[model samples]
Target chain A: MSTTLERPALRTSRKVPPSKDSRTLLKSQIRTGWALLAPALLHSGIFIVIPVVAVLVLSLTNYSFGDTWAWVGFGNYADLFGDVDFLASLWHTVLYAIVVIPISMAISLAVALGLNQKIRGLSFFRTAFYIPTVTATVAVATIWLWIYNPGSGLANGFLSLFGFAPNRWLADPATALPSLMVVGIWQGLGTKVIIYLAALQGVSRDLLESSEIDGANRWQKFANVTWPAIGPVQFFVLITSIVGTFQVFDLVYVMTQGGPGSETRVLVMDIYQNAFQDLKLGYASAETVIMMIVIALFIGVGRLLQKADAND
Target chain B: MRRGVGLTLLAAALSVLVSSCGNGVIEKSTDGVPPAEATGTLRVLLPSFPPSTKGKEAFQKVVDDFHKTYPKMKVEPDFATYKNLNEKMSTSIAAGIPYDVMVTGVGWVQPFASKNIFEDLGKYGVTPDVIKEKSTPALIPAVTYDKKLYAYPLIADARAVALRKSAFREAGLDPSKPPKSLAELKVAAEKLTKRDKNGNITRSGFDLASATGFRQSFTTFLASTGTPLYVGGEPNFDNKAGLDTLLWIKSMINNVQPYGQTNAAQQPLVLTGEAAMGIVNGGVDCSADGIGQKNCDDLEFFRFDSGKEIEYVGGDLASIGSRSRHKDAAWGFIQTLTKPTTLDAIAKLNKKIPAYKDASNSPQAKSNPLSQFVADGLVYAVNENEVPSNWLEMRGNFDIQLTQAVLGQKDPAKVLHNLAGQSR
Candidate 1:
């Protein structure tokens, strides 16, 4: 009986210290929180939820742009499996992402580590690196077009200085996809570098000092101390980078146009051709559905990895 | 603290997302009155022409003249480049706020008409007979679908060969008598081709594998070669003429380095004396009005003897939107622009051949010798039927296969065979 009485007293002391006015204050705080979140929630519902639902509905029907529509019931999705062009595009997109993500992240992280050092003109270097991220994609693509010109472009001109013959950078089927990969890496490096730089700055100096005292080499120190400290950022960067690379359309469009016999064609470009050029909205919606599933799978795997890292 | 920043960033992102998604706003007209009795503003869309200020001024002047006829109504003009016109029309129609009247490409009539996005001009007194009388017979089928006319022919375009006389003289070839047969053309090309010490072609004899990709030029070649592209609603490129044309293209491709040149390299090649001859659209002015007077002074049109004398005819067309509230006003506006004098002025300013026969034979058009050639060529020119809904996709597929063959990636016979199989 005495033990039970003590438990009750403990429970009361922990929970019941509020008056009516305090309870009112708590309720108002909850209301304020919801009010602050309302605009974003509404926007997401309108844009994200509605469009996703519409695409899902459209995937089940032959929904052209105007009033004509019919319930096809899995017909579009079934047809996609038999589409040789769509399959080829899917394969190309995967290959592109596979090549671009690792190379892009590695280079960006390397540059970010270099920029994070106690070096002179650090701000200028960071600004210079970030300039490409701010430049319009069209402008960048146009400049690169001139640079890739075999006869008079800067790329061939540079190769000529080393006694090498000119190369058709964007024209040859064998080289076009890889050439675009290089452009993708170059254009994407800036944002990743900036993000990694911020994450690196947040790394604890005391941890680095202790690791150094342990007589760890630079690579070992980075592997043990810096990388673990920025582990979450690395996962975030990898996820975003993969997603960005999977949706690459502009560079492929401006440079190769999926040319030399569709060697450089990717998923998004294929979707565009079907949707706009061919006016196959129903078919395009189905393609978009496939893209959404791919992106979801990628993000799902990233989340699983993120949870696994947390467990570790 | 980090949570607060994350939410703030999320809010910003959501705002951008909402801004980018379309709102699905539609036209607000609920009036039951027929467009003929209604009075309102009319909108007209035209293609970006000549890429010059004078070209824009000429178009605006025509709009201003149309506005002069209707004092109570206003004419609003919008512009889009030829490359983007189809997308603009499709999006506008989808949004239900398409312009009252707009310029359309010859190939786009099918898609627009099939969707009922364009007004059937037959309902408004413009019939097939009217089109046959006013426009070339080749253009009659271009704007008609399901025996209903959807658009009025506006400008005319055809393919022709332009030769550099100076290069011919340098190659010890006569400029006046150009090659009439494929054999003669190949011989002349061989004689005129120039090579550097490295064995690289410095000056090409003929720019058949142009940097613009080979589709447009290939179509012109096919027509001139008397190859049937289509027969009984089927792609029929597996015949003798087709095979011969492919082999000819392959032979041309082997003589020079292909695919490294810029998109507009052909015109500049002729201008700068890097290519002796180039095939170009009839509307292109390489003379005093274009590249330079001196470079094009000796530029003469060559007639390829395909034995059938066939040429590719394509052009911009004009049509009223089906959903337009002021359809009558739009028709009136279209009529005003298509008038003989207005059409003549547009053609003169833009250096294009007028669609109407009277406009083509006008005093101003007669003064330009090239315009006469364009008009004459329209008689024998033919256009593929624009009715097939999948024509664009079919054409795109054919272009890819042709490019593969031209680049030596695939055998021409195999490519054509595969293309035929796919078409079937």
Candidate 2:
């Protein structure tokens, strides 16, 4: 490495740069980049990669939070298929992801479109919508819980003026998931809207002007010009949304604790319950690994969709 | 049910086998020598609060007091919360962290004791006679299995209703009395309930019975109503009181009286005075002096005065672990805390009833509501250890089932029957 650096110094010049020396210099720079990156790589490997691998290994064991964990290969996985609870949780999580990811994307896109118009309060609107993303989960959850309260919650209280009976948004099994989904969408929209807004603003006005001149209506211009440019941004949001929905734990934990007779119970909730409440660490690890795989599949599919759309 | 039977028999057989290895009687210490005052460090572990903090400061203070008398042994205290305390303790013990004393709740005594976590005090020369008069040996049954005493039972925590005296008066009921039976309480609840024109309850007369959601409070009523949760070493929540209790709670929500809104999302209005009365944890919280006193100062206690002699009394019990390295220190702590004088001090200070029979009459201890409640319900206290692995998982299942029942999504009886079958 030192010899390569010396060679770059000795042979390389600015106007007639030595290709060999430049290549050596690049190699030396790359070596230094890796050296600097080692700590981060080591951290991710130890904290993230190693634990993820352990979860896969633990997925085959019999472990609760308190009980002495023991290896029982494929026991947890086998149990997962046979367990009605896990199946329900899996279904709930998938449905939640299916509903939330798309709705959040649409709302985000709408806000992004509005922001792309160069509104007078663009910065204020941007900050206002993005505020929820920065708010604490617990604080946001608490406020939303009040807003969703059946009798006196702000939502029901407002609805009551028109003679609507109080709806137990968080308590009713049917409403609970949707209520949480709304909150999730609300939280995601803040960040998603900003991303799409930036991407939309980056679109060339010349393209839209040309489309308009070619007799394209506002809707046609949007469909033909604006949307195509922001496809990559939409894909970015899509991948994140899909991955996030599968691992929804904190909201469920705080809002319902997977209650109304496990109606709101999701895969992540089951994993946490097994690990902490039931002290079944190994079993939880198995559930976690299953979630990990689901996330990976979602991201994989998301990437494919992005590629296909981009090609189109 | 099969697991329950198998575990019980295995435990019984193990205890018998272990006894056969010894002289059949577990003594305090293995050696024949008497318990002479020896000097060493004795470590005591508990949460920063009860069910360990009860005797902690007192224990340390007394240890200091005792050291002035003996000038020898040292007593050290360890504190953690109930949430992760047990895990920390279990991990520490499993990894040989050398925890000498564990000041834990009494419920854990049997499971860990049967597992031979603590040295049997009886094996070390602690005789039945010493425990009989000194401690509530009645608790030994919960702490012991197959004639081996594992944990030293120290205190009994009881649960009782803390009705607001002012609310009772305003509702045209006697402040001095509570409902004599579950049926009567339902009536009282009706009178206490205040509603808006929109049919929304403004002030709930009583807690939505499912508020506890199948906890010790809910189970206390189950037991009070005579639910046969156990029979002949078999599970027995298949009948009357169990179904009755569940349905009665459902009725309280769906028909007779629905008070405070069930959605906690509705900002629990009681502390804010929206609800009139609630069935609350009768631990120190209900005590006139415990933490809840700040908000519920006007709250007064009444044992569920079951018109019959059968009322339900449930509270936590403190016990020494069988695996404790500081068994002697623990015994000393238990003995001191249970003594009428000290028990009275704690009971009065915390505003709870003392488990010791004598503390009921102690001037300071009896001045509050809990002691009087316990005095009313002494005959009704129940201590059945049916499938007692802390009842935590079962509690979860029951909470969910009960929630469904309260929401009127399922018939209480049917839900309970399913829970009974599933729990077994």
Each candidate: fraction of true contacts kept?
A: 0.25, 0.13
TM-score of 2: 0.75
Residue pair clashes in candidate 1: none
Interface DockQ per candidate = 0.28, 0.10
In terms of TM-score, the best-performing candidate is 1
Off by over 4 Å in 2: A1-37, A65-69, A82-84, A204-215, B1-155, B162-179, B228-234, B256-350, B354-357, B362-364, B375-379, B410-414, B421-424
The most accurate candidate by lDDT is 1
Tens digits of lDDT, candidate 1, B62-93: 76776666655666677777656655655555
Q: Residue B71 in candidate 1 has what lDDT?
A: 51
- TM-score, chain A, candidate 1: 0.90
Candidate 1: how large is its RMSD?
5.5
lDDT of 2 by residue, A20-133 (tens): 988999999999999999999998876556556556655666533222446799888887887656887898999899999999899989988887775698889988999998
Worst 10 residues of 2 chain B by lDDT: B1-10
Task: Give the CAPRI class of candidate 2.
Answer: incorrect
